[model samples]
Target: MRELPEIRFLTSGDVTGAEKSTAETAVRSALAGAQGTVTAIRVTLSVVADPALPRPALAQAIVDVDGRRLRAQAAAPALPEAIELLRDRLSVRAAYLRAS
Candidate 1:
């Protein structure tokens, strides 16, 4: 069996848990954990802040595999949720990629 492909997490500003996008070793990790048959993957995160209102951070990950593409985004009270949601989306895609 082949190992999981890499996974990349890109961020704009200080996202609580995750540092700057591609900080530390995200690029390396993503390149290592991408199990999905995603021929290509794009992870982009933009920080949207409202002073009047405290809103949860939003996260989105877009995966391009062959002619099929999958996009996942989740708005959670915390940054972790956003990450998990995005991962779940990718996981589903990974499964599909592995199966087919």
Candidate 2:
């Protein structure tokens, strides 16, 4: 079986330790099944917060697989949720890449 691609993350903004961990885990899980297909994975996360809204967090993710790049943006009430949204979006793109 081919080895899974190395995943590198570039993060910025108000990301906390726990949130970073969660995002890493989510990215790993999201790409776990892509084993022999993916050559490399890079995910960039940018988190934005609004003082007026204490609950929701806005985040954007730019995912690179092999030489292709895709972008996804999401807003959720928590960091994990926002990360999950990004992972979900990337997973779809990954699947499409594999199919083609």
Candidate 3:
């Protein structure tokens, strides 16, 4: 499969380089299996200000597949976990979009 053109990562200082790589890998892996003209891919990682929340870390992805937009989001106490969740969710959604 041809490599994705560019993956834009939107994050704050709280997000580390390792976490960005992890998120990028996860998104690429998920999108690799998708069947379409992937025009753009954007992943956002953020930490909620409220520490009281159970899952402060957030991962979100927006993929432009054949001009259609598909989105997936996940939250966890840790960035890695959130990225994992995002990958799985995005994979499923992508597959469904392809099927339909």
Number of backbone collisions per candidate: 9, 0, 0
Using all chains and alpha carbons, the TM-scores for the candidates as numbered come to: 0.56, 0.66, 0.94
For model 3, the superposed segments whose C-alpha errors exceed 4 Å read none
Off by over 4 Å in 1: 1-10, 16-37, 51-55, 96-100
Clashing pairs in 3: none
Q: Compute the lDDT of residue 39 as modeled in candidate 2.
A: 51
Tens digits of per-residue lDDT for model 2, 1-100: 3355566767777777777777767777666555244555565555656667664565555555565765666677777778888788767766776787
lDDT accuracy of residue 65 in candidate 3: 90
- Candidate order by lDDT, decreasing, is 3, 2, 1
lDDT (0-100) at residue 19 of candidate 2? 77
Writing each residue's lDDT as its tens digit, candidate 3 over 1-100 gives 6678599989963898999999998999999889888999999999877779999999999999998999999999988999999999999999999899
Highest lDDT against the true fold, candidate: 3
lDDT of 1 by residue, 1-100 (tens): 3433355656765464443343213322333444445465566554566545454566676666656776767666555556566566656655666677
Error of 1 at 32 (Å): 9.1
Q: After best superposition, candidate 1 residue 9: deviation in angstroms?
A: 5.8
Error of 2 at 36 (Å): 6.2
Task: Please report the TM-score between candidate 1 and the true structure.
Answer: 0.56
Q: After the best TM-score superposition of candidate 1, give how far the Cα of residue 64 lies from its true spot, in angstroms.
A: 1.4
RMSD of each: 4.8, 3.2, 1.1
